[model samples]
Target: MTGFLAAVLAATVGAQAPGDGADQRRRLVEQKIRLVDILINSPAARGAAEGHEADARALIEQGHQAVDDARKALADGRFDEAAKLADDALRSVSSAARRMSSGEGALSESAQRKNLQDLGDQVGMYRSSIEELAKDPQKGTGAKALLRRVDGLTAESKQLAEAGRLGEAGKKMAEAYKTAVEELSRLRAGQEVLLSLKFDTPADEYAYEKKRFASNEIMVDMMIAEGRAAGDKRRLVDGFVEEGRRLGTQAEEQAKTGQHAEAVKLMEQASAQLVRALQSMGVPVF
Candidate 1:
């Protein structure tokens, strides 16, 4: 009886170890899901989806659904199921990434030029929007500084494009676009200019909040990938990302409980945390 009891105690101790197999497996699966999420939401994947690439869209959707199911399985203590789903999600997203890469590689020089032109046009539109906001007395005072930054970025992007550095030009334009959007959002907060959309319902507002949160998530991934969040900054950025994710989860919970207003507010806060994280990494998001 003594020996049997000792064996049982040993087994219990093993099960409760800091590096227990089950806990390790759960962590690994969670990491994979995060990686899959980043890949699916990457610029390449997004470009393909925007271009109406059916395969890319379908694969991205499948990966997202798998990730959702994996999270549910994890919550229910179905570790094996969660692991399988996470693996499946990673595979789907990887395939989509490959497809997007191939499509981009197939683009002709002229096509690339056209893409750059489109980005420039987008920057122009953002500049116009900011200029219009500058005409508003209530918002104009704060818009002046942001407008100057956007103008500088826009000019740099144009120079990059003219120099045949299309890729760099695209990045510059994206930065300018992000700055413009963030400035507009800041200036128009608490007004009908919520991202330039007047929500007809709380649901619409919630949807917009979710979109913004997802965009911020992508920016976080980009910063990490670009190695901007390294050394001591990595830990700080990670803290902000974790906080943002926590708030985003809370926002979803609130939305599910029909507290749409609270949900939108929480989500906005979540996105703000992510923006702060990006800034901490020296990203020129604004």
Candidate 2:
């Protein structure tokens, strides 16, 4: 893409509305574009849009390592080492953005803009997701608050996306994912909470302990108790089917990582979960 288009794109990103609605705008961007669309539509900017993002991932991976080291440095009071590592990671973000916006880069301006927009939307999705999760009764009120960090990131993502700076946006996404995982790791899982979540149904509990298949008695009883419950069998079946798909995907990931034994165990668990999720709604799961 031409310099004029790139400038215009950056300006548009700068004008993005900040707040919850920004996330909805981001989701729209994802539904609208792809990486290959960059190469095909804007040959001049393709490298900046696509190739630089891969480079950014490598940088972010290095940043993760540095952050790990930085933690140790902080604990040991090695301030210099911790500072250096943090600076390195921050520089990676800046460097990646610069490369993505290089005028001589091959990605077309349109492709770069679309790629950035998609990243912004994902960041927004994470931000809004965390906000909504906070309101869920099933979620822990004790979960560590990372909303402020995520908000900063959503803003960065929006800025980068509008600039058609996919490479930087990709790196930001890596950081966002890392922060989210860290936030989850910080959650304190209390014994009381664990016990509260446990199933109290005697028969189901007994069956679980024996590693035996679940009997349909409880489900049937519940259906009978709630007069119109059977009417929603199709919806219930759909939930099972969707959950089964997730378990299968996770199983595939485990296998790919060379944990074949664990993978088999997970796959078996997934199968059981799938069967439990799918049985009796009209499609037989046996």
Candidate 3:
């Protein structure tokens, strides 16, 4: 890859579309290309492609040409065409990569073991984060669902490893880690919203509540959706949900009777119950 070609490639990969249907296809193809690039650029793969496997070398050249053509098509405002060319590149590169080595990335057994260990550590970190969130009582159904998935994946990975299928096991563990990281990010976002509700004065409390009313409503709705989505992975949060609704209603009643301070306290209590429900699902609220 020359400097000019590398610059063009970077620009092509970084481009974002408004709402192109081909965007996903392009992204998937790009991932495949990178994987293939790592394999074929290695000494082992390079030797295999250049020596005793003329077909692999040809495929590598074809893949490079296809990528270049795809970049040109995108520059010319032809996303669909570019996407098809990218797919062609991916296919050629993948064929070459396989011919170069039986394993993905031509990973040796030691490298595979190290990769699996790293993935396990990543999953463990996510589990710790989830457990921390679980200490909260008002958020976590969505995260709990994800935790269940991680558990299943972890078990499956262990079974695969026991059966001597290290490659497949490593892939499953890597996927589990990725899923856990994504769930952790979602829980973190929810935590941020809840933490913003604190106030030091009654006036400040009332003012902040008014300002954040819409956000509070959205967060509540989000919790309900997460709870519903938890399905069989659901936690026991119905009582908390009911308590939140009751407190919110009472808060409204108090406000109607000119009990401003009491109304604010009741409203805060209502929010706390809702937050607790979210925490029960492993979302950290503080």
Candidate lDDT values, in order? 0.69, 0.43, 0.58
Best-performing candidate as measured by TM-score: 1
Global Cα RMSD, each model: 12.1, 22.6, 19.4
lDDT tens digits, residue span 1-286, model 2: 3333233234333232223664454432321121112111232233343545466445445545555665566556555555555445434433443444463333455554544444444345445545655775666463325776766775686677668665566456545644543353344233121211244553333323222111122222222233322455634643553454456557568767766556555555655654554344322323
User: Where's the lowest-lDDT run of ten residues in candidate 2?
Assistant: 31-40
**Which candidate number maximizes lDDT?**
1
Clashes of 1: 0
lDDT of candidate 3 over 167-200, digit per residue (tens): 7897688667656655667777744522223468
Q: Lowest-scoring 10 consecutive residues by lDDT in candidate 3?
A: 1-10
List where candidate 2 sits over 4 angstroms from the true fold: 1-106, 136-144, 163-166, 185-286
Whole-model alpha-carbon lDDT for candidate 1:
0.69
Give the deviation of candidate 2 from the true structure as CA RMSD: 22.6
TM-score of each: 0.52, 0.28, 0.38
Better-scoring candidate (TM-score), 1 or 3: 1
Off by over 4 Å in 3: 1-95, 100-106, 192-286
- Kindly list the per-residue Cα lDDT of model 1 for residues 170-226, writing each as its tens digit: 667667766776677678666664235578999888986776666566557656766
